[model samples]
Target: MAGNKQPVSVLVLLYTAQGRVLLIERADKPGFWQSVTGSKEGQEALLATAWRELGEETGFAAAQGVLHDWAQSSVYEIYPHWRHRYPEGVTHNTEHVFAFELSEESTPRLNAREHTAYVWLDWQEAAQRVFSPSNAVAIRELGRRLSPLS
Candidate 1:
């Protein structure tokens, strides 16, 4: 699969203790908002994928804050328009989930090539704004995870 992408991906929910989650508008799909996400490169651990995507998409480093592996994965059908990036027969993707907490509210350095704009919204609003069901679920989960502590 010379030009094929790995079916494994990572979804990083970037949030603050106050439950504000960061979402980026995709350059490819202007209205589509999502958390930090990207496919895994050959042999890379899912955690590494999450860290790489976080930096690549938001210019945020895992070392700068708390990055937690939520130990969750979701299998979903690949979007038809984006399926061409994967092997011809690959129709599904497994996305691992991670949660990153910033020390406080901070602006994300958006990657213009992948994302055109960024916004920080309340976790509930962020969940509603995301285009992917899985991404939305992760945002809501982040809220649940923080509720007890808040």
Candidate 2:
């Protein structure tokens, strides 16, 4: 119906040269962890959405990090609990993946109503720690790209 969200979203994973990935705890879901993610507002471009969400969710400065577009996308079913945020009959979401390379691990000012805490862990650990399968896969993919063996 009207006043519902589009099913397009962005997932921005922040990582460092040391392969540490940042994971944030959701304020609403306590233990549920994820990278910075949010839906595209109206007709916003994907890059704009990425930057908007990064700043909105983590208080990260737009000019502070190197942002990379993984040129990857995933379509997954929206969790039942969050379906209400989208329009009627919208069961799936198309998430574009990106990564921000930080020079080093840094603390983020979490949005109190969106996220409560943050942790920086090894890429593998972060992949396993995130609540969404797609997010996990993206982190693992980042690991593979950053790994010497890959």
Candidate 3:
């Protein structure tokens, strides 16, 4: 699989039922906050990617609560520094969106190699705080989905 394209990844917007979103600062880029995100390993399914990344990056297990597949995907340019992880000609990635709602607020044990810190913010503030356009789009979608009916 060395030269094969990296499978699509998942971006899980971890939030509370009350609409607070979780944002984790990237260890590689301090002050850059985002939700759980990672590529699939081998032939693993995309949902599996979401579950695995959640556990690996934040110590959260999907079975313990709600994890919904938003059935949304976005393609965006792969940041230059991380492009080497994908195939030579691949310059973009398709990220599937998911949501994890915890029963209540909880502290995440971040993977120090991947993230520097974590915060819970109101959805609007979370959307503004995310660094990636695709990530921000996903946050907006989450807001729309969770908003109460008029």
TM-score of each: 0.95, 0.96, 0.93
TM-score order, best first, reads: 2, 1, 3
Estimate, for each residue in 1-150, the C-alpha lDDT of model 1 and write its tens digit: 324799999999989999999899999998999999999999988888988999999889856789999999999999989988998889999999999999887888887999999999999999999999999999888888888865
- The predicted structure with the larger lDDT, 2 or 3, is 2
Write down the RMSD of candidate 3 (Cα, Å).
Answer: 2.0
Consecutive 10-residue window with the lowest summed lDDT within model 1: 1-10
TM-score of 3: 0.93
Ranking by lDDT: 2, 1, 3
lDDT of candidate 2 at residue 141, scale 0 to 100: 92
lDDT of 2 by residue, 8-53 (tens): 9999999998899999999989899999999999899999999999
Q: What is the lDDT of residue 84 in candidate 1?
A: 81
Residue 22 of model 2 has an lDDT of 95
Clashes in each model (backbone N, CA, C under 3 Å)?
0, 0, 0
Candidate 1 C-alpha RMSD relative to the actual structure = 1.8
> What residue pairs clash in candidate 3, if any at all?
none
